[model samples]
Target: MAGKILISGGSGLIGTRLSEMLIDQGYEVAHLSRDPDKFSHYKTFRWDIQNSSIDENAITYADYIIHLAGAGLAEEKWTKERKREILRSRVDSTQLLLDGLRQHEHHVKGFVSASAIGIYGNSGDQLMSEESSYGEDFMAEVCKAWEAAVWQIKDLGIRTVILRTGIALSDKGGALPQMARPVKLMAGAPLGSGKQYMSWIHIDDLCRLYIRAIEDTTFAGVYNAVAPHPVTNQEFTEALAEAMHKPLVLPKVPSFALNLMLGEMSDVVLSGQRVSANKVLQTGFTFEYNYLDEALESFYKKHQN
Candidate 1:
């Protein structure tokens, strides 16, 4: 028998890919969206996260719920208002789902949600694991609250897994495309000091991790969803340039410039912390694209064709 799945943020990059992948794997998928007319594969329900009004039917018939709703961290400057939106987008959405699960008649077996490495902050040369201390930054606060909200579902006796994801690489709407754009134009440059470690994973691997979390009953707690090998910002740029068959000639973007342009959000660009996917791997999950260069090549080839 196929499992029934409910997904929030089904229209976003990771959510869309994960929904399609689940459907292909023979799961019945439903999506909760602010707008329901966008996709045909899944039943879309209206939900205002702030008001906590979710379609009751959407909550009543699921075996699993994957929450990936959030504002794009890099979509705008980290002004006071934008920061509130970012935090509210995640917390409110998760709260809505939790309320539905508590108030509605759903037999949800498990909960899977998206998290980030930003919670660890700038770790310099230190290696971060799931047990590492949370960073004292805006992103860290957001992640802390975001994860806390989802943790509420666990209290309801639902199996829960939080994916503390790293930068997801893909040609389909992510940091990769923006990075690729400059490289394809032969003007690619490393960002900041180029020493910041970028913990990254292929989009395919990320989607599979979520699937594994749902299918594998024993999987619970936090798992760092990153590739085995973490590369520095310089290495990422070079690999991207190589994949595009372009020369890396430009100097690195200065940290000060990024700070000036991005404001508080510059932390995302100028600083990075290395994260390990050891916990996820220990669960017997295998990565299809574990290396940075290999993943970039595959992505570039797909884009070209």
Candidate 2:
């Protein structure tokens, strides 16, 4: 079932690794990028979401499409305008894909789009699954709209899968880098109450899930892409500190100070939901890095040399 796999946001954290893994599996990979020259690993195709223009050939060449395009939600302060950008980037990018596909003659088989467990909002220690109730917040709303647009791909008779992904732990350029940075300086501390559940997946496991979505025809609808065992913030910090051979000597960062610094974005870190990966497991997907300690060990060892 491995054929041409075209990806949006192919230059992003997940997409970069996913592209490499897919290529290794003998799949012809191409990227839908704003600048064709940006990626050297694959044939990059040009796309303009605002103008509703795309390299129609890219759409025609696809057996599967993994839509990972979206602006970083936690990268900046959520001003009124930034909020609109966060929601618009995902929704509009999807619309552009649909519009381009409608105009092109394509034999695309499946469409797998990235989503977030944030769809469940900050539900404290609640164990959230794919069927969990949606929480009322900006993240949930954004995920709701983002997923709604992805669902429309099914209207084209393309099998679609929406993965409600959690925090992906990688040393590349995601939360891990920012988290490990403080620990490296011996200024590490648990965030907020340190009791918020952090549902996370190793980057390798996440990349494998995307591969499964493309190959598994029955993989329709939504699934949470998180590790089965979620750890509290305190546990996560301690594991990371131990991995780096550092000690956590500071008190938990107060929620008030975090709110003052990051505003609404602080809620992303301060509050958490324990997401379930049972749905993904039922499909016989095995995770290589299920525990934080093991995953971090692999990440650190890889870059030590």
Candidate 3:
């Protein structure tokens, strides 16, 4: 085993897989959760963000920490209350971790946080890099504040790395499963204009990046965690249909219908930016699946049985 690693929101789609990958690589993994008992296999520590409380041992037992706690952005309609929860769940939980670190004298080595490409908003076909301008939308603001909270860890003299992740494609549970369903049933089509670029990464590659952040001392600052090649929604749909051996015959899903059904969340699917992987690649990081077709094929091949 290597160093002890603690993850906040370690039960989510990315975190669950990350914890397993870290374990398989001989690093001990633990989780920060509201209910510790729910995760019997791992050492679980409790943290109630609204209450401003975190388990003391969680801080003391970790050599490194990865923060991935956040409310689902597209799970429901964006009401005033829901917006507050979406923002607070990420910002406040991070603040709670900082608070926990302050209460105890700890020697944590590094902090890796998960940010999102939503910060770029609906950039159409514009190529987005880490230094790109921030979008002036609800989700953009949420991501901005989320990263701002993570930046506070740098003051403690710990090297912090922030990854502005794009759409994470995993067969287990993520955008891929949802996107693949209608295609499998032969109803898949382009969403909206289908020109909005989706910068995405395979789950296995993303887990490798997280592992790299922990092991590589120079992996600091912000990097866009996406594959080198980005694709349009139409291209993505076509590739997926090809991967599953299904034919794409349906017309493009209209923007108006999607807007009516998804409300503000429709923007998540209908709008996207072509995010760059140059920064991470410059750091010598490589992707296992760099092309959209290959990534979709890999996922479908594993689950076709």
TM for every model, in the order presented, reads 0.97, 0.97, 0.98
Worst lDDT 10-window in candidate 2: 296-305
Candidate 1 residues 254-277, lDDT tens each?
Answer: 888878888888888878889987
Worst 10 residues of 1 by lDDT: 296-305
Q: What is the alpha-carbon lDDT of model 1 when measured against the actual structure?
A: 0.90
What lDDT, from 0 to 1, does candidate 3 have?
Answer: 0.91
Stretches of candidate 2 above 4 Å error?
Answer: 302-305
Report residue 173 deviation for candidate 1 (angstroms). 0.8
Better of 1 and 2 by lDDT: 2
Clashes of each: 0, 0, 0
Q: Write down the RMSD of candidate 2 (Cα, Å).
A: 1.3
Positional deviation of residue 251's Cα in model 3 after best superposition, in angstroms: 0.8
What lDDT does candidate 2 reach at residue 39? 36
Among all candidates shown, the one with the greatest TM-score: 3
Give the per-residue lDDT digits (tens) of candidate 2, residues 53-104: 7888888888889999999876899999999989998999999998877888
